[model samples]
Target: MKKYRIGIVGATGAVGQEIISLLEKREFPVAEARLLASANSAGRQMQACGNLETIQETTADSFKDLDIAIFSAGSKQSLEFAEASRQHGCVVIDNSSAFRMDPLVPLVVPEINPDDLEKHQGIIANPNCSTAVALMGLYPLHKRFGLKRFIASTYQAVSGAGAAGFDALENELKAQFVPEENSSTATKDSPFPHPIAHNLLPHIDDFREDGYTKEELKMKNESRKILGNPSLKVSCTCVRVPVYRAHSISLSAEFSQPVNVPDAKAAIEGFNGAELWDLPNANRYPTPLQYAEKEDCGVGRIRIDQAFDNGLSLWVVGDQLWKGAALNAIQIAETLVEKKCLKWM
Candidate 1:
């Protein structure tokens, strides 16, 4: 077996930490692991592959000895360091929105487009968290029944906003029991414009003039690219829920061919990275609590949509930090390995 040196940017953050754990958990033939983060988090220590690795500041020099680099930092970090890593003869699989829509970079979901790795110009882009979860259900159906369009409403977790968002939700939940005098200390600084303890925020990212947010737009555009459906009509409403992890999406899709409940359930069950959990009569369906931290996305509530002639309605849930971000990025690398797409190797 061949082992490759790997580097994880933003090693101190939530998604970055998951990347570290997953690399070891899934055993991706890592010979060496380098943890890189901002200067402030440089000296931090993290456990990986049963050893404590020291975090280093991310710079151009970070990738010289690495075979693969996974970027879990924000777009700014990816934009600044991704090309530099690629220039160092390293393949970059990015978790940010940096190069997803770039014609040159391959926007991949390993289950949907693993073969696309062959054309990567040293960088691969992971889909949006919500888009990734939605596709786990939609893509399989698209294969069985040609998909026409989809409308989705996502109940995203606070973890999607990162650790700070998690803290905000935690603090607010604690503040509920605190007296008014000390409540300010708990619910003071929040990443969301509104409270997320028990309430919901329909907005996820910056709003556009068309009344859609950037996060909403990501689901539309990214889905089309991954599915190879440029004209695919997608409308999504993104919401932030108080959950600590995982994301749930309510999807209604129109397909070219007629869709029935049994065939739809069969498609989901047979798909890789997706499990059919529909048993509403038994009071079972995919939920954020059920799918959190699990690798497979769960799809349930399959039914024929009355709104469209050949349409279906379903619910999908997945761990955003895993299938949505870290797991997906790692899968890209695994696909590259399996397909022998790593040019540097």
Candidate 2:
């Protein structure tokens, strides 16, 4: 196997940091590893592979010699630099919404559609964390029953918003100790509209004309792309929970044929990136707290849905920072290499 030269944009941010750790943890063949950040954050040293390397300022020249560039920067940054990175002959796996909807770029979930990697024009888009987690359960069932529609309610962790969201939750919870900051206005500048400590925010992103938040729409749009189901209807409600890591989604998916609980469990058990953990009698189900930092997305609370004739209800959870973002991007890069779509260094 030929080692590839890799670069990471947004190396200091939440998802970016996870990509760094995953690349090391997965033992990705690395001819060289380069870290890049904005000018303000450049010059900092990150310890990796038994050595400390200085983070370079991102420039047009940053991707000059790299084989793959993993981007976790915001959409605007991705919009501006992804093409530049690709122009420099680097394959960009972007963890931003900038290119997911683009006809030329592939929106991929390796377990669901690794074949999408073949259509990439040097850029591959990662699905939203909530969308990614929910489909882990939904896709397997779809394979058996043929998916037609889905309804989902997501319990997303604070970390999904990045470091600011996590910091806001941590600080607000800390403010409770001061005895004078218990009021709602104490965390007014927080990422959420209300204090997210011990509270749930129904809104996850900016409200669209239809009243669905951007995060909610992401679930609808992204799932359709990943599953190659353009007619797949998704109704989603994304809620921000006080949890700090994994994201959980409660969903009811209707299929083309009648669904069975035993068959659903078997399908999930056999799925590549999913697990069946439903045991109501034992009161055991997949929970965000339980699946934190884990690789496989967990599915539980499996049952036949009463609302639809051929539907199943289930709960799914996975660490968004991993299976949803970092690990997925790494897997796509690996798939490209394995298929020889991306050249070996």
Clashes of each: 0, 0
Tens-digit per-residue lDDT, 17-124, candidate 1 = 899899989998999899999999988787887778899999999999799999988999999999899999899999999999999898999999887789998989
Could you tell me the C-alpha RMSD of candidate 1 in Å?
A: 2.3
Clashing pairs in 2: none
Worst 10 residues of 2 by lDDT: 177-186
User: Which segments of model 1 are wrong by more than 4 Å?
Assistant: 177-186
- For candidate 1, what is the TM-score? 0.96
lDDT of each: 0.91, 0.89
Best by lDDT: 1
